[model samples]
Target: MKNYLFLFLCLLTQNLFSQENVDKKALKKEYFTTAEIDVKPEFPGGGEKMYSFIAKNYKIPESKEKIIGKIYIVFIVETDGSILDVKITKDIGHGTGEEAIRVIKMFPKWKPGEKNGEKVRVQYQIPISIN
Candidate 1:
């Protein structure tokens, strides 16, 4: 009976510890949007290179209406420096927003953001213009 009780207690303790670890992992996956982070994520070769990449890769969809405005793309820079959840927060019509998303998705991994000296996932946004 004592041995059974000891085994049960050990199992219970392990379950609790496992639960804590799961919670920690969930927290780590959460992306921060606030400007309070110690460092912001950046492109590998800086803003100019990023823009150049976009200019080289961005494809404007042929539209009868002639799309001519700025679209905003938002995404999460993961702790590992890869991007996730690409979205167009604001956009002009004619497939421009989707084009922007595609260009952003093709981008290489960025320098991950940091908070409290630890690498963290961060929300980032950029604007693209269609002429």
Candidate 2:
């Protein structure tokens, strides 16, 4: 009985470690920057249209002190033309960062960037100036 229990424990430990390794390998995906990619991702229309969308959708948070400056948002444009991992790299306080994230999340599917003529994930960043 003791020997059987020890064998089962060893098998379980080995299985767990193998699964962890597989998970790490499967979760790793290559991401390229705008400069590294042959084609950069873009909104449905273009820069002007994107800005228009943001202007139309973004709402400033009411604050005692006026909020001004630039907020930088970073995200990954996946190969399927979907946005993921949206984050605010820079914020100027007053809940503007969170607001920017909210607006970005509402955006429609973007044209995915490409490299070597194949669609690839790309890290993208944009700065929004608030005044």
Candidate 3:
């Protein structure tokens, strides 16, 4: 009986410690829109650099049907400067949206938004053209 009790206690302790560790890695619950923030998030280099990066990375998808228009993407910039929840708000078809998403996923960390002197996640939108 003592042996079983000791094993149960050890298991409980291990489970509690594991849960704590998981909680530590969980994302914070602070999110704000760009308009709601005092300072909007920025790419690591700035607008010009961000545009350059995008131009360099973005590939124009090829389609015999001639897919032309803009692909609008929305993503959250976390307080830790990481991007999350990338989604396509508008798509031009012909894999342009997926290509835009792929390039966005390759983007480096951002500067993170600030609101009330605290780092916060902010929603950002970008339009990619496929002409």
The candidate that achieves the highest lDDT relative to the unseen native structure: 2
For model 1, residues 45-127, the per-residue Cα lDDT tens digits are: 99999999999999899987877889999999998989899999998988888888888999999999999999988999988
Candidate 3 global CA lDDT score: 0.88
In candidate 3, residue 46 scores what lDDT? Answer: 93
Query: Candidate 1, residue 17: CA error in Å?
Result: 8.0
Worst 10-residue lDDT window, candidate 1: 27-36
| Over 4 Å off, model 3 | 1-30
Q: Against the correct fold, how does model 3 do in TM-score?
A: 0.75
Worst 10 residues of 2 by lDDT: 24-33
Estimate candidate 1's alpha-carbon lDDT, on a 0 to 1 scale.
0.90
lDDT of each: 0.90, 0.94, 0.88
* TM-score, every prediction: 0.78, 0.80, 0.75
What would the C-alpha RMSD of candidate 2 be, to one decimal place?
Answer: 3.3
Candidate 2 residues lying further than 4 Å off, grouped into runs, are 1-29
Two-way lDDT contest, 1 vs 2, winner = 2
Best candidate per TM-score, number? 2
Error of 2 at 18 (Å): 5.8
Q: Candidate 3's error at 54, in angstroms?
A: 1.3
Please rank every candidate by lDDT, starting with the best.
2, 1, 3
